[model samples]
Target: FSGTGTNMFKEEGAQQGFSSVTKSIGFSTDSITFGTIENGHLLLFETSSSRKLGEGRDCAYRCQDLESGRELALKMYKITNPDQRRAIFHDLYAQRSQVGKHERIVSYERVIESENTIFVLMELLNGKDLFDVICTEALTEEKARVLFRQLLEGVQHLHRKQVIHCDIKPENAMLLGSLEDGTANLKLIDFGCSCFKEFEADSRGCVVYDSYMPPEHVADSKLSPSVPTDMWRLGCTLYIMLVQRPPFHNDAQTQAGLAARQAGQLFRVPEYEALSPEARGLIEQLICGDPSKRPTCDEALNHPWLGLA
Candidate 1:
């Protein structure tokens, strides 16, 4: 037998068998189907010439809904091992309820299971991610408040439903227009890590980017994501938007050590401060060492920093 195992990749046109596995360009339109489309087949296209969006373990395809004639993003997960695949598929299925459509959160269409893979259909977004938007300069107080209000509204919706977005960061937040335009809509995406957890609870270790991971998350090994953890990460994300860098970010050579140190350290506003006292105070409260001290989503929405109080 060949050493190559069963791995899924994209290719153009239709074909079958192991040789087709070498198709390096686009996914086979034949094998992929969400279900029987009354209008026609589900047509798939590349987001760019590269034929994929983003990098890492996840693969997303830009497709058109034949019936609705709307653009959608298909997030595919290729898991060959049966056990691992089943676990992932079940986890996503279980969390399906948590991904309800919301104005602030990216809309999740449905989950598709085909063979050993899983496809997550979501609303295709246009414009830039928060990381790209905030990388160069700090956001103006007005713009920051607008974005923060929208973000909190979305998070509040999730928290009310007992869904904790375990991973909340600038990269997870998408902007619809240029930051300068002031009319840009912000939508929080990537709910794959989200799960149900109560406020001030502990969670397991699934944090990839520790800079934004809260002390409670880093300290607790058994706890899953909690409301306080999400709020803490939101605080870090806000700090990045206002200052273009995480509050605990450092130039230290050892990133892991730095992140561990930051996770254990009490929250502090860095010297790169630009926001007013109220804004800083709000951030301090959000990232307070103790999870119970952080404000709830509604409380945060009405915080004086956003000038909404």
Candidate 2:
């Protein structure tokens, strides 16, 4: 909700779509603690830290697990209506339960539902998301490849489990570890728009930016949203990671993206020519209009660009 990104190429840090990423790395000391052990449920926030960690439909707070004493982030959804929330995630709880946890997916520890809120307890991430990295840090194709490969691994896991992360983008993926001093690993996060089946997943559930969606999303004919949507999103994400801009702008530009997607002209940006052919080729294939032509995560991982061989 915070991003007001423009469709122009001049402004790099401008956020043109939905602001789903947690851009705040630091928290404010102003804090309040709300919860009790007497109620058999308690979430404590230390005064040394800020209560709210991120922004969006839900807010994350630094909290501690009473039993384990381990630190964790508590994602609180204010809307208490289960049905409304389900309309956004489509059996959100059930689907996530099926996906469970993975090396690349954020691990959920507990789910607590109260009369007015839904609280999800997850492992605390120690690094910035891909969006922030692209904005603030220096990125190289090698580093992008490192993160993209892990991202593909995570999505591959979801697809293998018959899940499609409709909201695949730079914002939805985060890097683990101290980015300044070490090689950071990627962990896919934010399952608010994730789904169990391609057809069952609703675009409404995906707070998708116009540019991130595939051409199929706009077609009027009979078509159910599918995992291929995720592939298109991946292409957009990868392109943004390397070029510091989404391949498609939003609204009008997205319409242009459809044409480019059909023509295989997605790599027309000036910055693209400087990139290695393998990298550009993979991006072109991923952003192609035909879903059948797009490579699966398995095939993408083995692509010459990723250099798995």
> Estimated TM-score per prediction?
0.75, 0.76
lDDT, model 2: 0.66
Model-by-model lDDT, in order? 0.63, 0.66
TM-score of 1: 0.75
lDDT of 1 by residue, 1-309 (tens): 112212232221111111112333565533333432224444332222244667655556676665567788767555566534433543353335544467888776655444445556678888788888888666877788888888898899888877777778888888897656657789988765666443224335344345666665455546566788788888878777787766764432255534544443433555445468887888778877678888999889878878743
Model 2 C-alpha lDDT per residue in residues 10-74, reported as the tens digit of each score: 12111122112233346434432323233454443331235567786555688765456777877
Candidate 1 — which residues are off by over 4 angstroms? 1-34, 37-50, 82-87, 90-95, 178-182, 197-209, 250-271
Best by lDDT: 2
Off by over 4 Å in 2: 1-50, 79-84, 87-100, 178-182, 198-209, 250-257
Best by TM-score: 2
What residue pairs clash in candidate 2, if any at all? 5-15, 5-16
**Candidate 1 CA-lDDT value:** 0.63
